[model samples]
Target: MSLTVDIQFKRSSKIYHQGPISLINQSVEVTKSGKIPPGQTEIPFELPLSPRSSSKTLYETYHGLYVIVQYSLRCDIKRSLLAKDVSKLQEFIVEYRPSNGETDEKKAVKFEIRPETLQNVRDRARIPQFLVRGHLDSAVFPLSKPLTGELTVCECERGISSIELQLVRVETCGSAEGHTKEASEIQNIQIGEGDVCRGMAIPVYMVFPRLFTCATTIAPNFKIEFELSIVIIFDNDHLVVETFPIKLTRN
Candidate 1:
């Protein structure tokens, strides 16, 4: 038997900030086992951001700018039919909150989701069938000025599963001229389960090229906008997977 999973985003939302700020919002929708069926499930989550009083504001002087926002999806499964054993699955949680007073416009932020954790749940649950899939919508926004810098993403743990990072895609746009470009670049890197039980970090780096030719338009005034997409596949009789979007800016 094969299990199927489906995910979706209701709306491509945008957030605005100025002078020390914290924002939290949900950016995706996830559904499993078809539209509406037995044992089917749907989960919604929020992305949180908090400002740091110690950090300097991006627009202390005032300017218009924007940063790309990314969303992540996570799932955990546990073995054992016993309520106590299965209940341990609840303890396996994935939390994503902003570190400090960092705005999407000031510096690019990288977000990671654990794959091993989810696989562990499946093993504990003793489920014979497994399947996972993720989907994201297409949308973009303009942010208030004084954009932050670029972001680098590194995965620390393989978590709970025996899956590999199969695909990664990146997209970028010129801030001053709005010249947009996108690339599917996951093949450039090698992804594997470093140490099944201990977990490992997958590193991803992105660089934005400068487009302006004249000095007048180059007073540290060029901006690079980016979008990152990723996909993962698990080792099982059926397919198990996860995915999300990330946005960043280069100063």
Candidate 2:
């Protein structure tokens, strides 16, 4: 019996740019000899983890649009030539310990989202008059806690169909020549719907998914970042978006 530990960091060839690559592929012998006599059996073993190369380091497990970092463990048992070998594989998550240098301060950010403040609008003539005021609890968020905020629609000429909060992940892969950056939505949650009451505060909340996000990472070869978008869709299908860049840390 043997145990194999594999960690792969790859860029999707179909959706993104590069081919699949393996960063770490190593295995350890669990036991020199073993026999299974009964129905259910449990064996205990331990394996130390480290990257194969001296300069390489293990990154946290992350799933992104352009890049992916993953870890898995596989167990294999070799039988006679007539009997096929048995194997099982399972995925695992890896996270870094909170750094002692991390600060505990939380800074709130306030903003006003109006038609004039929308940056991505192609046509100003199509946007209706609207004013939205809000403040995020903090610009920096702990990965274990939920992102919280509140927003109020002070005035709007047209009715609203839905108000949504979207979490986006930005992944940058670097090479000797240059770097390619890709941004994709991780999750979107609707906080308000169907023309909500004017001047009434609407609550904003979102949980960071475990497998999809990690402490905003900046490495030599690649970088990972996150951003938030506040989308307001009108009844007539006209939409306005407000984007905010956020920092994520491990507490």
Candidate 3:
């Protein structure tokens, strides 16, 4: 028995905007002509993702609350002169494919805003600033699947008092030990304080928490994003908000 192989790339955070970050360490030997008096043996290798700072093509395999990139294969065995040396490991995933008229693959995230433009630019903010809009039939979801949406309140002259829907989890973490956290899940589609309704088609259902949901990722420091907010509560105080960017996949 004589073997040796090591191929690795694991980066959750190390910081690199573009140049100088390579850690796909490589090694191979694999029991050349020795370890098998039995059966089954096949070893082939190829690992090269070199000097890549451009030509962007691979990054889609994520588990994020920060970042997570993984791939590993380690095996070392030797049974010779005194015998005693063995190690084995396997944990792998490196997938990002799109090359036939490549559009770079990642679609389904629609956007449209103007719920007071997330309110805060008030200078006596008026002029049709409350007609809401929202739609998310699919923004990539399958964490036990239940997120239907459609909220189209065509006009609001500061009448509706309650209509809030928020399911947010935006986490960002840096490697020098920086930290940020956000978690939310609130639901109440519509409920006026007295009696209010301008134009309505509101129907939004929400169910999120497969295992505390996570599937958006980006690394350098770390990032996790998922948002869906539409709060148009105005019985006169006027608080209109809008946001959308969601992906809670485990598919």
Candidate 4:
């Protein structure tokens, strides 16, 4: 039997990120005869989790639209010429160890969305008068905790069709020569539908998805960042967006 651990990095067609690096590859002898008997057999083995060299470092496993980090194990069984070789591959997750660093004070953010605060408006007179008030409990969030906040529609001349919270992942991959950055939506959750009541507080809550997200990472060659967008769609299908950049940590 053999064990192998490989880390693969790939780029999209439009010159993104590409490369597959092997961290560990080793052959292990499980049986004296190098053969297995009939029906059912159980074998137990243990291997140290370490990189092949001192220079190589393991990164957290992440699945993104254009960039991905993955760790996998493979076991191969050799057979006679009459039979074909058999192999099995299993994927595993890797994460950074939580640090005991000092915690930062939680900072709450208050925001108001008005027509004047909107951007890229071709004609301000076309937009209905509206006011929105909200606050995020904290600008920095731990991966294990849910994002909590509240928003209220203070006043609006036009009816609202829906209000949604969007989580976006901004992935940047490149080297010293250049880099490519792309933003993709990880999830969209609706907080309000139809005409919502004025002066009523609508709670904001979102759980960071597993595998699709990790602690905000910054490396020389790549970066994994996150942001949030609050989308409000009016009855006429016109929409306005407010974006917020957030920091993530493992506490």
- Supply every candidate's count of residue pairs whose N, Cα or C atoms clash at under 3 angstroms: 35, 0, 1, 1
Model 2 per-residue lDDT tens digits across residues 1-251: 23333333345433434544455666777766557777987778876667667427777888776777777788888877798998998877889888789576898889999977778678888789999999999988999899999999999999999999999998888755477777889999999989999999999899999989999989777889999999999998989989999989897
Sort by lDDT, best first: 4, 2, 3, 1
lDDT of each: 0.29, 0.82, 0.54, 0.83
* Candidate number of the best TM-score: 2
The local lDDT score (0 to 100) that residue 5 gets in candidate 1 is 17
Best first by TM-score, ranked: 2, 4, 3, 1
Model 3 accuracy (lDDT, Cα): 0.54
Candidate 2 Cα errors over 4 Å, as ranges: 1-23, 53-56
**Residue-level error in angstroms, candidate 1, position 88:** 69
lDDT of 4 by residue, 136-188 (tens): 99888998899989999999999999999999999887855567787999999
lDDT of 3 by residue, 128-197 (tens): 4555555767777755557776666666555666777777767665434455454445334442343345
